[model samples]
Target chain A: GIQVEQSPPDLILQEGANSTLRCNFSDSVNNLQWFHQNPWGQLINLFYIPSGTKQNGRLSATTVATERYSLLYISSSQTTDSGVYFCAVIPFQGGSEKLVFGKGMKLTVNP
Target chain B: DAGVTQSPTHLIKTRGQHVTLRCSPISGHKSVSWYQQVLGQGPQFIFQYYEKEERGRGNFPDRFSARQFPNYSSELNVNALLLGDSALYLCASSLSVGTDTQYFGPGTRLTVL
Candidate 1:
């Protein structure tokens, strides 16, 4: 089994500030995804970066598969960003394609 | 296009009771996976079904089971539920079985008494 660990389990920032979340896994992965869990418990897809870097609006993510880690960056955050951010990966082991998720990082953006 | 959809947004049950949760995947998607997330914890994988067949299962007990239908819809059943079973059950669907992005539903909040 693979292990996923997220850093800075709890984060609080001002509405206009920027932040970065990190995720480290114990094994090689074939797929990696970042999600924003809203207060209503909806897992909103943020990015699907197995490797390399990608950006969407004020959010961007970079994954260094060789290093078994990934980073998610939020620029000029908003109040709506107050929620839990999760990183999940599908390890390249066995025949199973199940995603092993990190404990998640709780982000609080105060206006 | 509609994303993954789950039924009974919330549920309450007693210990030893049996419960079933339903999910319909996005159109053209043939893989459905189930995950359980406890309070203050990350979501844990339960089962993965592809093409109406069981492809992968997590470390959950035998009380947890799931099946996918011909239409790619899925049902997750838990027998003799325990208090520990109370959590948010999420259903995710991907276009294929391996190395694809999984889109999740809003999830069903289950409470066991």
Candidate 2:
């Protein structure tokens, strides 16, 4: 089984500010994804990066498999970005491929 | 195409009662998985089904069970619910059982009283 740890459990940022979140996994993972859980409880997929770097508008993520860590960066953050960001990994343990989620980083972007 | 869908956005149950939750995965997806999200915590894996077979089970009690249908839809059954079982149940559909990305449903809020 793989253990995932997300840093900066709580983050508060002013609108238009920038922040970065980090995730570290205990073992090699076959898959990694970032999700944003909105205030309304809707889970939205942000990125599916197993390795390398990817950018989607104001948000971008980079996963370094060898380092067993991933980083998510938010640029010019908006109030709407206030929510929990989850980092999930699948280590393919027992051939299940079940995703193990970290507690997540709670971000509050105040306007 | 439609994303994953779940039935009965919310539910209320009492101790010693049995309840069934349903999920419809996104079109063209073949893997369905369930997770439980307690308040202020991340979702924990429950069960995963691929190709109508049980692929994985979480650390949940034996009272919790689930099965996948022929059409890739799935149902989760919890028998003799306990108050601690109250939480949000989320269903996710993946393009495959291994490394594909997973999309989740809005989830069903279950309140076990």
Candidate 2 regions with alpha-carbon error over 4 angstroms: A92-94
In the range B25-81, model 2's lDDT, one tens digit per residue, is: 999899999999998999999999999999899999999999999999999999999
Worst 10 residues of 2 chain B by lDDT: B94-103
Poorest 10 consecutive residues by lDDT, candidate 1 chain B? B93-102
Please write out the lDDT profile of model 1 over residues A1-111, one tens digit for every residue: 899999889999999999999999999999999999999999999999999999999999999999999999999999999999999999987696998899999999998
Best by DockQ: 1
TM-score of 2: 0.98
> What DockQ would candidate 2 receive versus the native complex?
0.79
Task: Evaluate model 1: give its TM-score.
Answer: 0.98
Expressed between 0 and 1, the share of native interface contacts present in candidate 2 is 0.65
Candidates in order, interface RMSD in Å: 0.6, 0.9
Top lDDT hit: 1
RMSD of each: 0.7, 0.9
